[model samples]
Target chain A: GAGVSQTPSNKVTEKGKYVELRCDPISGHTALYWYRQSLGQGPEFLIYFQGTGAADDSGLPNDRFFAVRPEGSVSTLKIQRTERGDSAVYLCASSLWGTSTGELFFGEGSRLTVL
Target chain B: GESVGLHLPTLSVQEGDNSIINCAYSNSASDYFIWYKQESGKGPQFIIDIRSNMDKRQGQRVTVLLNKTVKHLSLQIAATQPGDSAVYFCAENGAESKLTFGKGITLSVRP
Candidate 1:
């Protein structure tokens, strides 16, 4: 793809339900990132993947939030027992090499609304 | 805990006028900085980036100024157009390859 792509542009789920958001990064890009953005705020780091392994997951917030990139190209973010506080936009980004320069390309993002 | 934050919450500029948005960061160890623009229902797009080694960088109609002494960053947009209306964010790359972002500022370009 020309740019990073994300699925389920908008998802409204009841509290305690499980939801998954997917991201397809640009072809040949090896670094992937997941971020969460609440209304009126900037994107917050969630997880970062260098290839199929998670290089960092310190920003996951809790055990309910998890992400994986099994093939290194596409990634998925899963939330278990979603809470109303989880309502926000989940963003995905990719970089050619690493985030050394902070120049990662971002996707449209998936809006999750936990009702 | 180091963090980045905007000086203001909103900036309104007239079409054809110049616009400047300011940001402040607390971390002195940050080596890289980037400016991102986000429109409604879309993700953030990179505008310009400046390394700690450089004080300034310029793009098509945008310029980023970095002042490490005070940990301040600013984005300047020339001849702002209606299409330029969007939210702008300043991000800093810190430890662990993580980019910490500040709360965005809304840029409103009046016609």
Candidate 2:
């Protein structure tokens, strides 16, 4: 894709349900990142992937949240036992490089609502 | 823990006026800073960025100023327009490779 792409733009699931959000980064981008944005707040870092490996996962809120980048291009953010507090806009970003100074390109994001 | 923060939650400016948004970061080691603009229902878009080595940077109609001594950063937009109404966020790169973001400020442009 020319830009980052996210799937399941909006999802409403019951508590305890499992959900998976997908992200397709721009072609040739080696750095992928996931973030969560709550109402009236900026996007919070969730995880970062350098190539096929996760370089950072400390920002993930809890064990219920997990992400994987199997091919180093497409990534999936999985949530187990969803809670109402998990509701937020999940954003995916990709950068040409994994360097600290690289600018990130973002997607529209997937809004998850746990009822 | 150190983090990036904004001074105001919201700011209103008349169309065609200049707008300034301020941010403060606590980490003294942070070397990079960026500003983002997010519209309703859309993801954040990069506006401008500045490095610790430089105090100022300019884009098409935007400017980013960094004051490392005071840990302050600001984004200045010239000729504010209705299309510029959005939430603005500031982010800084600390010891880690990830960028830490501030809560963000809503910019309302009045015609």
Candidate 3:
């Protein structure tokens, strides 16, 4: 894709149901990240992947949140047993690797609405 | 608990006037700071970024100032326009590598 692509621009799922958000990063971007933003708060980091390895997953709120970037290209964010509190905008970003200062390119974001 | 925050959650500016948004970050090891502008129904767009080594950086009509003494960051918009009305977020790239954003400041430009 020309830029980072996120699937399901909006998702409305019932509480307790599972949901998966997918991200296709820019070509050759070795670092991918997931973030969650509530109604009035800043986006909080969920996970980050360096190539196919998750270098950091410390920001995952609980065990229900897990993300994987297999093959080092596309990544998926899985939410198990979603709760009403899990509803928020899920943002996906990608950047070149090796440097921490590389600017991140963001996708349109998946707006998850857990009813 | 380290946190980044905006001094004001919202600010209103007159058209063609200059606007200033302030932010405070608690991390001393932060190497990079960035400002992002997000409009309704859109993703965040990068405005400008500044590294801790440099106290100031400028972009198109925007300037970012970093003050290490107080761990503060400020975004100054020259001649604010209507299109500049959006939520601005300040993110700090701490030793953690990824960016930790501050609670956003909404910029409202009144004509």
Candidate 4:
């Protein structure tokens, strides 16, 4: 079975520009999550979706960051006005169940560079 | 938006030695803890997980020890090899469904 997959392995954009990153979760996974990883640091939670609605998004850093999962399988993280600080790897993961107790399968991730 | 964090920034161990990484979490209600290994240019890979109920759980060559009283967690790897070099992060999920992660410890293997 295919693991989680993300598109545009690398993306470079100017500051203040808008961009979107996509995620395709594993089949039969009812839970999906988004995280941000900075250099020499750990991944910070962004948001999580259970089915078609976001179950938890309190981790989102600010209003500039937003995510959506319309059909319950794939998701997209959108940035309204990118900043240099927003440059990092955007990771997407999914699990068999919706709870945090289950193990997660992660994608390689999409590296976003804002200059 | 506080989260779990690591006690040590880095650890350097020789091949065939044992390595222990520590993490401290603030949320006591966090019953679930997970250890993830992330290599350069890749996303985090699940290494092992332990619930608050049990004090210890073992995997292939890795073990997770959780102490709810101190709100601390540790990952022990026996006979550490060069391939085990990577960044280790501990995540805790409390009553909240979100899994907050630690600062991470970089493991360097000296062969």
Winning candidate number (lDDT): 1
- lDDT per residue for candidate 3 within B21-79, as digits (tens), equals 99999989888899999998777888999988999999999999999998999999999
| Clash count of each predicted structure | 0, 0, 0, 0
Worst 10 residues of 2 chain B by lDDT: B92-101
Writing each residue's lDDT as its tens digit, candidate 1 over A1-115 gives 7899999999999999999999999999999999999999999999999999999999999999999999989999999999999999999999988779448999999999999
Q: By descending lDDT, how would the candidates be arranged?
A: 1, 2, 3, 4
| Candidate 4 Cα misplacement greater than 4 A, ranges | none
TM-score of chain B of each: 0.98, 0.98, 0.97, 0.96
lDDT of 3 by residue, A63-99 (tens): 9999988899999999999999999999999989722
Ranking by DockQ: 1, 2, 4, 3
Per-residue lDDT over A1-115 for candidate 2, one digit per residue giving the tens place of the 0 to 100 score:
6888999999999999999999999999999999999999889999999999999999999999999999888999999999999999999999988537678999999999999
RMSD of each predicted structure: 0.8, 0.9, 1.1, 1.3
Give fnat for candidates 1, 2 and onward, in order.
0.87, 0.78, 0.62, 0.69
Deviation of model 4 at B15, angstroms: 0.5
lDDT of 4 by residue, A1-115 (tens): 4889998899999999999999999999989999999988888789999999999898899999999999999999999899999999999999888545588888989999999
Better lDDT candidate (2, 3): 2
Ten contiguous residues minimizing lDDT sum, candidate 4 chain A = A97-106
Q: How much is A114 displaced in model 2, in angstroms?
A: 0.3
Docking class of 3: medium
| TM-score, per-candidate, Cα-based | 0.98, 0.98, 0.97, 0.96
